[model samples]
Target: MARFNRKGTTKVLFVETIADPGYMPTATELGTAIDYSKALAATDGWSIENQEIETPDLASTFVAKIPGDDSAADSSLTFYEDDVDDDIETNLAKGTEGFLIWCRKGRTAGSKGMDVYPIRVASNSAQVSLDNEAAKILVKCSIIDRPLQNATVPTGP
Candidate 1:
C-alpha cells in the first residue's frame, strides 16, 4: 500500500459571478485561477454532513429512519494575512459571489487527482492580535451542490 501526503497538493479558488441561478461553474468556464496555497496555512479543509430523520412507529421499538436532504459539504480556507491581496478581500466581502474550489495532487500527466467544489462564501473573518505571531484570515463556505470528482483540470488565461 502507498501512503499520500499533502506535499504536492495544489489548491485554488476561482471567483466568478453566478451565471445561472442554481448552477456550478466548470473549470473551463473559470479563468485566471487564484493560487490560494500561496497564503494558505495548510491544505484546504473540507467536511460533509448527511442529515438524519426518524419516523415514529408503534409496532417497533426502534423508529424507522431515513437520510434527509442531500449531503451538504462545507469547508474553510485560512490564509496568512500578509499574503492575501485586496482583490480577494473585496470579492469575499461581496458575500454573493460564487467560487469554485479546485484541488489537484501531483502535476504529472498520469498523476491527475483532482476535485472541484462549487461553493458560496458563508462567512469571512480574520484573527488579529498583538500577542499572536501572525494575522490570519479564515473564509468559510458551504458547497452549492455535489463536488465534481476527477474533474478536468481548468486552464489558465
Candidate 2:
C-alpha cells in the first residue's frame, strides 16, 4: 500500500446535472462540472451511521440490539470567500441541488478513488473572524439519496 497525504491530492467539483446519482459520471460530464477545489478550505461530516434498536424481554437478562435505519450524517464544505462574479456564492445558496464529486487521489483517469454525492445545499453562512484571517463560507449539504462511492475517475477532456 502507498502512504500519501490528502493535502493537494483532493479535488472537489459541483455538477449541476447528473442523470443518475448512483452511477459514476462519464469523462465528458465531469469536464463540464464546476471545479471548486481551489476555493475549498475544509470539509466535514460525510459519514453514515445506523440507529440501534434495543430488544428487551421479561425473560432475558441481557438486552439485544440490532441495527435500525441507516442515515447519512450532516456534511459541510468550507470555502474561501470569493467576491469575483459571485459564482460560488450564488450557486451554493440555500436549497441549491447538485452533485458533489470528491476525488481523493486526484482526478487521474483509471483511478478508483472518487465519490459522487447527490446533495442539496441546506444552508450557507459566512464565517468572518475578527483576527487576521481570510473570510470563509460554510455550506451545509444534505445527501438526497445513496451516493456513488469508491468510483473511478474518468479521463479528462
Best-matching candidate per TM-score: 2
lDDT for model 1 comes to 0.61
User: lDDT by residue for model 1 over 109-141, one digit each (tens)?
Assistant: 334555566677887777676784677777877
Cα lDDT tens digits for candidate 2, 38-57: 99998998776788899998
- Badly placed stretches (over 4 Å) of model 2 are 56-61
Candidate 1 regions off by >4 Å? 17-31, 42-45, 71-74, 104-113, 150-157
- Scored against the true structure, residue 79 in model 1 reaches a CA lDDT of 65
Q: Global lDDT for candidate 2?
A: 0.87
Clashing pairs in model 1?
A: none
Q: Identify the leading candidate in terms of lDDT.
A: 2
* Residue 23 displacement (Å), model 1: 6.7
